[model samples]
Structures are given as C-alpha cells and as structure tokens.
Target: MHDIMFHKKIKKTLSTIEEVLNNNNKNIDFDYLLLDNMLEITFSNNKKIILTSQIFLKQLWIATSNQGYHLLYKKRTWICIRSKKTIKKILKKEFFIQTNYLFKLNLLNNI
Candidate 1:
C-alpha cells in the first residue's frame, strides 16, 4: 500500500485502541501517547507497549517488554510472519501477561 494509505490505517487502528482503552480505563489503568505514526501504551505497572507502522514495509510493528513482533497485512488481517498469529490475538495475550487483566479489543470494526 502507499504511504498515505498505510498512515491512515495505522491512525485509525490507534484511535480505535485509544477509544477502547479510554472507555475501559476503570478496569485497566493506563496512559497512551500517539507520536507521529507510533502509539505508546504505558501500564500502571510501568510496562510499555509500542505499536509502530513501517510505511516502506507496509507492516505494523509491536514491541513489548520481552520481544518484538512484525505484523504484515495478509488475508484481511495483520498477522505475524513467523507465528502466523493475528495482531489482536498477540496483543491480548501480551497485555494479559503484562497487566493480569484481559485486553478486549474489537479490531474488526476498525480494520
């Protein structure tokens, strides 16, 4: 996809995530910052999750405490190239591990 299209997609996805988190802030306390094409989520425990879009690669990259995942748009979903897992699934799992709370994200509506 073109740079503009990729940026738009990333912006929409980040906005959706922010909305969801804001609506559920009582249950999950966190702060988020959107800088350029990146979203940085900081949990109450000081754990951080970063989501960044690579325009040239046309991929979304997610970084957590222990590892980083590069997700490519494929089959109507963003999936990890090595694990073949969806970004939403990975995020849910990672968030739960980091916060001991389930991360419920409805990516279908945004994507």
Candidate 2:
C-alpha cells in the first residue's frame, strides 16, 4: 500500500479504538493514550494492548498482553498473515483474556 493509505488506515484504526473506549468508559475500567505512531490501552489490571505503525513497511502491529501480531494490508483490511485474523479479532480476544471485558469495536465498519 501507499504511504498515505497506510497512514490513513492507522489513523482510522486508532480513532475507532478511541471511539469505542470513550463510549464504554463507564463500563470498562481502562485508560488509553494516543501518540503520533502508537495507541496504548491500559487496563485496570495494568495489562496493556498496544498498536504501532511501521511506516517504512507500511504495516501496522498489535501487541497484546500475551502475544504480538503484525498486520498486513490484505483485501482492504489489516490481517495477520499467520493467523489470518483481523486486528479486530485479535484485539477482542486478547482484551477479554486480559481484562475479562468484551470490547465492542466498529472496526469492521472501518474495514
């Protein structure tokens, strides 16, 4: 993908995360910080899920409490090549494992 498109995707993804967290802030006990190239969500338990961008590779990555996934642009979605899972899927699963809170994200709409 082109640099602009890759960056746009990353922005959209982070914004989606922000929207979800803001909407569920009362129900979910978590805090988040958005940086120039990264988004970090910290749970009440102190576990974190972080997303970062690799501009040179035009790629996005997610680091959960237990594992990390490199997301490649495929079919207009960011998907893990090995697990063939979308970032949304990996995030939902991992957050539940870490915090026992089911994250409701409209990332599919962004996709």
Candidate 3:
C-alpha cells in the first residue's frame, strides 16, 4: 500500500525534473541514493530530498494524486524535502543549467 504511493511520488518528481531540465539551458545535477528504505535525491545546487523508494506501476496509477513541491539548495548544501508538494514549489522558480569552466575547457580541448 505505502510502496505504491511512494513510487508514484518518485515518478512524478522525476518527470517534473526531466521536464524542467529539458526546457532550461542551465545544468542540473542529480544524485540518486537509497538509504534505510528512503530514496534520496541530491541536486547539483546541494538540495536534497528523502522519500520512500519503491517501485509501483499498476495498470491504473495516477501521479498527481501525490504531493509535489520544490526545494532550494546551494552548490553543495544538504536539504531534504519529504513530500512531492514541496518539490513542485521549488521547481517553479527560475532554473538554469550550470556549465563549469573546466567542462567547457575540456570540451574545447577535445574538439
């Protein structure tokens, strides 16, 4: 029961992230983790979120039923949002893709 709810939340969150990333030129970093039955998502800005990590995809499933919100994080701070509602709120802000000089340099060097 709880497992189903958790996966739906994760999928919703992931979908939102992917959508935002696709629309923006700013680079977004994502570190996915599973600790003690919790799924942890660490963003490049140092924001993190912990939620139940379970796989639930039934024939009749809905994602919006779960909460959604956004979280703000620094370049490498530790922040966690436990619900989807919070993730949505955070994502509403301006999103940018971060490109490091080193990465650009490497790309240039390669080219």
Candidate 4:
C-alpha cells in the first residue's frame, strides 16, 4: 500500500480502538493515549502495550512487556509475521495474560 493509504488505515484502526476503550472505561480499568502514530495503553497493573505504525515498512508494530510483534497488512487483515496470528487474536491473548482481563477486541469487524 502507498504511504498515505497505510497511514489512513492505521489512523482508523487506532481511532476505533480508542473509541472502544473510551466507551468501556467504566467497565475496564485502564488508560490509553493516542499520540501521533502510536497508541499507548496502560492497564491498572501498570503493564503497557504500545501499538505503532511503521510507515516506511507499511506495517503495524505491537510491543508488550515481554515481546514485540511485527504485523503486515495481508489479505485485508493485519497479521503477525512470526506467529501468523491476526492482531485481534494476539491482543485478546496478550491482554488476558498481561492484565488478567479478557478483552474481546475485534478490530477487523470494527473496521
């Protein structure tokens, strides 16, 4: 994808995540910040997850306390290059592991 298109997709994805979190603020115990091309999420336990857009590579990168995932936009979905897992699936698993909270995030459906 072109840089512009990649950026637009990233922005939309981040905004959708932010909207979901905002709407569930009362039910969830976490805080988030969407700055520039990064989304930073901090759970109540102080564990953080950072999602960044790599414009040069046209990929989305996710960082948690233990690991980092390089995700490529493939077949209309963002998938981890190493694990072959969709971003949503990774988040669902990681969030539960990190925060002990099950976050049923379906970014693709929202998009």
Best by TM-score: 2
Which candidate leads in lDDT? 4
Q: Name every residue pair that clashes in candidate 2.
A: none
1 versus 3: better TM-score goes to: 1
Candidate 3 lDDT tens digits, 1-111: 366654454555444444444444345456655444444555576654444433432211112212333332222211234432233332332122222311111111111
After superposition, candidate 4 runs with Cα above 4 Å error: none
Tens-digit per-residue lDDT, 1-111, candidate 2: 788888888888788778877876777788899998899999889999899998997778888869889888888678897799987788779878977777786655546
Error of 4 at 14 (Å): 0.6
- Write model 1 residue lDDT over 25-110, tens digit each, in one string: 77777889988888999988999999999888999999999899998877666889888988778888888887788766775342
For residues 24-81, write the lDDT of model 4, one tens digit per residue: 5766788888999999999888999999999898999999998999999887778999
Model 3 TM-score on a 0 to 1 scale: 0.31
TM-scores, in order shown? 0.89, 0.90, 0.31, 0.90
Candidate 3, residue 6: CA error in Å?
Answer: 1.2
lDDT of 4: 0.84
